[model samples]
Target chain A: MLEAREPMSAEAAEVSRPSRRGTLYRGDPGMWSWVAHRITGVLTFFFLFAHVLDTALVRVSPQAYNEIIETYKTPLVNLMEVGLVGAVLYHALNGVRVMLVDFWAKGPRYQKQMLWGILVVWLLVMVPGAYFMLVRTVTEMFGGS
Target chain B: MTLALDKPRTPRRPAARRNNWELASWVFMRVSGVALLVLVLGHLLIMNILDGGVHRINWGFVAGRWSSPFWQFWDLAMLWLAEIHGGNGLRTIINDYARKDATRFWLKVLLYVSMVLILALGTFVIFTFDPNFDA
Candidate 1:
């Protein structure tokens, strides 16, 4: 690579190199959490559009509605349901954190702590939630009562 | 001892010229966010975690639920709130990322179009849904 770049002087290459320091503002927890919020928000919105379309099938015929909805019951879709719920849950929890940060007197001071708090709460809810959500899929995969 | 500054670096907009629409949108996001936290999480629990989960969802189940006025209202409220909330969120995203004026304008146009389409379609379906429709 160094021999291949013999055309350009070393100083020119050095000057052209992008600065690595503070490129992403150091990406603290607050920034990362916000990014997650935006990503989940967009995904959920698109899913919402699709969901509304799927639900609209109810008006066409019972068979049509039932047939489309069946796609949701498959194993892959069930796991995706878990992921969807997880995304929504994170957004909802983080949203509350955001509100607290905006409205509460000491919100900014405690924002980082609240981020961790929400994460804990997310785990608390999701563990059992995943189990319950995947019960049908699990039952079908391995014979169960 | 503090050194006094002659003027602020970035002057604030005059009260008259300042727009409240952005503020209103900000407030709406927080308020609607709280409501949706309850409405949507409860919806997930009931629809995805309770009893048979998504397996229980079917035409008959929908018909049975819509047969009640309470659920009808619940669903209608959810549909409207969620669509608007999501639309507003997308609006913010578009404003943030779309650099060019034309790009931003057209993106918002697309957003608004789909928002209207989904709202209209969802509302029509809910209102006109007939449980007794023979297959």
Candidate 2:
């Protein structure tokens, strides 16, 4: 029965060819950087969107705006604010790297070095920022309470 | 093994001409991304790190900031650039993942709707803000 089957036509084979969908983050630094970039970009954008809306609430009524902002003063929200800072920092640093890659002649060759540079700068900025944000908020929330 | 070979497929539609809009958008992403770094970081520093952090953000603070043309313009630029940059980024994601034409079209429709709504509301609030409104 197997030997009785006819060969498939060349045109049929071409028509049935599968499209290539690229691999999803298989450990390449460049690929992972872009993944991080996209995620951080999306997170930051959504936060800003909500932020604008809430800020605009000031125009609705001062009381409403103040009330909403007051709620943002909790320790939990303050902690989350630290995360927002981290996201913004990563996105900004990676963005500069991306700009260089697009325009700088030697950028692609030096991308790995740039990534390390970004990491060093990120830690330098973020350590102090996280410290200040966490310390001040915790102190304000609990130091007097 | 079967000896069938693949045949050449019909030519795809001709590639579209590169227009000024495409070039502008490419430029806009890098330029706006850089600008956002400064504006957004300054904003975070002022709003979340200086003078008691989020506690300092209040109706009065917002009112005072908006009263100044400098702050108003600063926020306006940040708002416009961030929204467009974000929307464009999402559009690229949608184009990449939404394989079906209808899916891509509807997703973009939703994106544009939200973008326009937010942009309009944000701009309106910035310029027409009347801090003296009766509560």
Candidate 3:
């Protein structure tokens, strides 16, 4: 029997349901971009919450907060920090593009150009960001106890 | 674009009145996703790794980084990316669920309003943040 092509109402009831049609990322820029934005944004939201809570730990007691901060000083911890900042950065930049779409700044012909524009902007910011972050790490290593 | 001229006829409303919002949204998600992978991953590697760790991050850290045009650009990139991603996702949901023209229109207006305000506020925060604020 041939499988039903259209998603059925019952299928909607199931959680974590993915259609047989290959993932939408196979499509064009907007589909995957939208998905990435969503996944990253959700992740960012939770991470932001955690960041706030982690910082707030200091309010309870300096010793408690310092313990968490000390652990975050490791290489592995630094690695995660990169991921965190990256998530925040990408999500933020892409968010602006999405907002522009509302106003009709990009059309079919301009779509590719807009994508490239976003890339250039990302690079412009990232290079300096990386430099400063590195400098901070280096300084901390040599300057502090 | 040619297909756009060929209208989907419905007794209720003319196709001309209906814009190609859905198709544009579909395209946006994909493009944004690819960018996210690259930009976000790169951001992570640089901030967390590359040198020391979190203890290295402090007030001077923010000042030292932001003072440069480069990190300012980086913060700008991250800020724009997340905002667009989130706003587009919300747009998709609005179009999918909202039915009545008035409802959809107003909701979208509200969405855009909040979106702009947040974008402005966040951008200001990134650029104006002072690492040297005296406690």
lDDT by residue (tens digit), candidate 3, A1-145? 1110111223223433356356543544555665666666657744643553454443345455567776676656655655666656666666556545444533333544565687688788667655555555556678764
What are the lDDT scores of the predictions, listed in order?
Answer: 0.85, 0.80, 0.58
Judged by DockQ cut-offs, is candidate 1 incorrect, acceptable, medium or high?
A: acceptable
Candidate 2 structure quality by residue, lDDT tens digits, A1-145: 1110112324324543234336342444665777888888888878877888888898889999988998788888888998999899888998888777667877766776788899899999888887777776767667665
In model 1, which regions exceed 4 Å deviation?
A1-24, A143-145, B1-19
- Among all windows of 10 consecutive residues in model 1 chain B, the one with the lowest summed lDDT is B8-17
For candidate 2 chain A, the 10 contiguous residues with the lowest summed lDDT are: A1-10
lDDT of 1 at B62: 95
Q: B31-57 in candidate 3: lDDT tens per residue?
A: 665576666566565545455435455
**Candidate 2 — which pairs collide?**
none
Query: B1-135 in candidate 1: lDDT tens per residue?
Result: 365454645487344536578778877887888889888998999999889889899999999999998888888888999999999999988988899999999999999999999999999988999878987
**RMSD to the hidden true structure, all candidates:** 10.1, 10.6, 11.7
After the best TM-score superposition of candidate 1, give how far the Cα of residue A8 lies from its true spot, in angstroms. 42
lDDT (10s digit) by residue, model 2, range B56-131: 7889888888889999999999999999999988887787789899999999999898899889999999999986
User: What tier of docking accuracy does candidate 2 attain?
Assistant: acceptable
